[model samples]
Target: MVALRIRPAIVLFGDSITEQAFGVEGKVGWASLLASDYARRADVLNRGFSGYNTQMALPLLPKVFPPSKDNQEGSGILFCTVFFGANDACLPGERQHVPIEEYAKNLETIIGTIRACFNIFSSAATKDDDKFPIILMTPPPFDPAAWRKCRDLEEDGRANNVAKSYGEKVLELGKSLGCSVLNVWNLLEGATSPEVYGRYLSDGLHLNEEGNRKVHEGLMELIGKDHPSLAPLEAGATGEGLAVEEKLWRELC
Candidate 1:
């Protein structure tokens, strides 16, 4: 008889959306639901820190790396989802927005750090040719109507505009670095309208259940096309559990 082996799971690093899995009952984040969808196939670790920025994430890469084994080389983490720049674009006089240059540097540091870690862990058996895949996802477009209703329009506009600009730069960086990039901003722009925003956003910025569902479906489609291993998320019944787990992690963290 032959034994079957499982591959290491993917890691998600981001802010509230990623942390949504840890929300209280009935308020699970979309990412958590996504995780549950994949539970039968691959392990999905959600490391979303609410209100965090790229600067903070750049230093947390080590925690996401897989542990080493005794007999064989440590398995590499399959996917890394980098979703940031939200808190960095917080309202004026609140959280300071990271300058474009600094943002780029932070992302570069993250990618470099991950690559370096993979090299150190996998160097014993494999060559540089075998490297884990990394995915860079841009933050979703800020709902302007939602912003106007809940926040100071002028201020929110500035922040959203700034964040959008920086988001584009991040996408460009991803391409240059040879990483797979998901332009979430573009995806959400046309799908959502002012009326939709009013209902799906709790505060014009963060998403409500409907908003989360929309993002989740889009994410599944994107992941399915690019990363078939993650397709299970598109059709699974563990969304509730995944949501609970996400909420737990968020609160505990």
Candidate 2:
């Protein structure tokens, strides 16, 4: 029989970037790294929808992340991260183009729905208990010039400046709503040059290994800083087997 191991979980809602958390190469993605690091500490769920914009994601939220009936099954949800906007920022007239204003409203509604389902509206819940912390991660900046080489997108399918504005909106919503914001837009901008930054993405629009690591590091830093209570155990050079051995000896004696 499979052993039952129930632990708090992490719900990651996003687009393709999140879907690739566990890369095809077995263990190269950010989700893979985070899952390994969080082993026995927290369970991570990937709820990514490829080619989906916020408008698409918002409607599906009710079906996928239904109201949390805590203790209905496993350990229950501890945290949730919303990573989207890459596709949503697609230039107008493109298949996935969502107007900038609508995009902002969509994100706000998503957060509100999540809060309602998590029971944040309960009068008895403490600020910490009912208040499920939401992490709003902006989409990573893309290199449209590089993307053009790969294939033809719309007249402005994806551009750095255009993408930055979407991420800026996410940052704005996060601040006003008291949500944790992971600004991949500005974060990846530190790469200095377009070529250097391009290295972070495999297809000019998606994340590569280096990019995954950058994301993982940013997530780790955020978790450690904002939610120390949910941080994973730090690995040391040696295992703690000696302590187990000592416990056995003492019990026998």
TM-score leader: 2
Worst 10 residues of 2 by lDDT: 237-246
Candidate 2 C-alpha lDDT tens digits along 59-81? 89877677756432545566789
C-alpha lDDT of all candidate models, in order: 0.63, 0.77
Candidate 2, backbone clash total:
0
Worst 10 residues of 1 by lDDT: 240-249
Model 2 spans with C-alpha error above 4 angstroms: 1-6, 68-74, 120-130, 152-156, 235-253
* lDDT string, candidate 1, 184-249, tens digits: 666556245546434655666666776676767777776666655434532324532112113333
lDDT of 2: 0.77
Please list the residue runs of candidate 1 whose C-alpha ends up more than 4 Å from where it truly belongs after superposition: 1-7, 21-25, 66-76, 91-93, 119-130, 144-158, 190-200, 229-253
Cα-based RMSD of candidate 2 = 5.0
